[model samples]
Target chain A: MTRRQKRPFVVFGFETTHDALAAEAVLKAADLRVVPIPAPPVLGALCGIAMRIPPESAGRARDLLAAADLDPVTRAEIEDF
Target chain B: MTPEDLERAAGDSAVGGVSAYFDHAATSWPKPTGVVDAVVRALTVGGGSPGRAAHRLGLEASREIYAARTACAAFLGARRSKDIIFTRGCTESCNLMLKGLLRAGDRVVVSSMEHNSVARPLAVLARLGVEVVRVAAHENGTMDPASIEAALSAPTRAVVCQHVSNVTGTIQPIAEITRIAHNAGAVVLVDGAQAAGHLDVDLSQLGVDAYAVSGHKGMLGPQGIGLLYLNPELEVDGLLEGGTGGGSETVEMPSSRPDRYEPGTPNTPGILGLGAAVAFLGGEGAAQRDQEQLLTQHLHEGILDIGGYRVSGPAPGSPRGPVVSVVPDSGTPPELAAWLDREHGIACRAGLHCAPWAHETMGTRDTGTCRFGLGYGLTETHVDMLLDALRVYRS
Candidate 1:
């Protein structure tokens, strides 16, 4: 909920809220840490929920999502100041 | 005597407060075990704009809704949660299906025992140039697939039918009806208000294009929420459109499966309560159905033991929903219901029961019938309580 962070994060955006929730379930089950956040304006996904993950876990999360067939609509790197 | 005195007299014990509630057809009482708790929890703990914020509360609310959608889909025998659309109630679900599918000059086939939910909207669609065909139900209150097939002789746009008659409790042969309609290349939509919680409805195997259900009645959930299972193949557009928390920048509503149908802020609390209701169904559904049928049979047999009462619809042993509507030979329907409520502490629905056409079909249009709709938590003791009270009518 803090406005700023010390480290950059990887965000996965979805076209639908349900889809985003599905991805969250998959990543959480794989023992990866992720936070569900409002999709940033830069993603241009309209109104959607996106999952924020540590940059280190992005590869593992992507693998889990691919196997689960939860294709994220947009993937972006949110740089932290 | 005061109404409180009647309550004590009917309780049958020192703890005399429970009246025999026979109005499950209108809405199920004592909403299972978890419905109220879930609703309260949603209001108390589950807060924030779901899918519209990055906060933990917002994410949790969205998760609960998504979980509910999955559970509801499974309960209704649907394959994908994306296909399930939540509406205000069954009436709204019916309105959406009718408005979204039919066009001018298209024909829709319906039954004689339909509730106003279907008949009323079809009447408006009829005025708009849709050819409405009525399939006559047999006097026993069951629909004959042959009659439905006959109505489908001409090319029809849709066949709208009820899975169970709300007034008569006669379960229709929906699978057969759907097959008949599909053979004629017509879409099938069912009024599942009385059937969803009362019977085993497997939508995947049933193969109907759309089915609408009430959460308050058989599902034992909140009153404002209901469900519609739309076949993924059906291409009806959203009946009403607004913010769906998806694709907001688009000039139109989101093209997502259910979001296309659901607009504006979702009913998170009601939807969560409905979720808890269906989850209860997963374990207790068969037991609930069995208990309801047993009590219904007891009431039916007891009414016949008294000389002046006539039970309508299917025969006593016929497999039907858990509803019993009877006409008393000695008194009017309202009079019997009032007497039961005032003295015996039993609650019953009397008169036309909101289906005038169904009453006409049964030849009880004028006198109407005293209806006792059974459900969970009712036992043989309640049936005995009612039967004992009816013995006074012996002449």
Candidate 2:
């Protein structure tokens, strides 16, 4: 049995809310363009609030958040809400 | 709380929807949206045990814990985030600092308004050859710095004082006390349990050697998480020693800032919630504290207007924290509190509030006192409801 592929939208799940907020602030400042959505429930607990970015801006958003030392996003991704 | 929220929270009819929570001293309720979500996230998505290993989950958990430390450090105005150590709660933090720092034949100065958290530990130490001197508190629950200075006559090793009185909401002048203690070459350990989110506390400015706070009280975080700010210059032995993610190679506990203190697995979810709560409180604490002050004054004036009632703690306009203790002439505090809960759905504490020393100082040791600790999101409606309840009870 083969598993289905995740959607094109990249969601960054944070370990804590402050980390998500920090990422949100940096992404907005850098004009990377991301929207916050409830976690898709696939990932484990404590990262329920995640930042969703378009596939095009995922790289830039990741860069901005990384620069702030807020690498809260996990390796997981989801397609939609 | 909204009607929908109340309906959801009142799932159990026996509990009777708590219309208002005036027990911020015990633990704050209706935490920020981020706090609840943070806890949920940790349980569901972030399941790593922090400081245990370098695995993915462990690393993520460690990041969350470190973020909490940084938040607490910024909240307390510490020089660096590394100085903050996480504990079970303010009570444990107090025990760690007092038990680890004090030795036999050491003389310690404590305020009469201290909670049992500080008083009991000192009491046990007293039997073990530790000299404990208590500076009496004024009727209004304020500790006179002059009395503390006079008591400092004998050489003391340390001074333990609460930044705010949990029973009476009395705000002590800690900066002055810290200065006096430091002048006599004594280290100061401030119990900031009731003061952290209620007042502006800057460790560097206060110049205290150690400060401890409960994250769930004024900080609007989940319980089971406490913060301890130890000035790096001060050397206090660790109360507990076990597995600290680092320094496993050495048979002895590693001499480090936090690793030396934090042993065993920590409450990662609680710490994450605290980090989120502190972040939510970022830069807006002064405004929130000011609002609570206004509410406190409003409650004080309202209670006074309800004839035959006497309110304790600092007067209406005086500099104070958000807690208020009331003594009605007609009924006992527990009776009034029960009526408030059963009849009016109001929640409050009616007892010594774990600060028997404070009640003793206030001369209400026998009857105890009904304490209303106001916190975030408490509006005039709740205050009015409480006032109306008190008036009805009197009638």
Reference contacts recovered by each candidate, as fractions?
A: 0.75, 0.00
The clash count of every prediction, one per candidate, is: 0, 12
Tens digit of lDDT per residue, candidate 2, span B229-315? Answer: 888888888888887654344568757567778878889899999999898788554567788989999999898888777788888
Write the residue-wise lDDT of candidate 1 on B249-315 in tens digits.
8778777777788887888888999999888877765687887787877788888877688788898
Judged by TM-score, which candidate is best? 1
Query: Candidate 1: where are CA atoms >4 Å away?
Result: A1-6, A55-69, B1-18
Q: Which candidate is the best by DockQ?
A: 1
Per prediction, the TM-score for chain B is 0.94, 0.96
Deviation of model 1 at B217, angstroms: 0.8
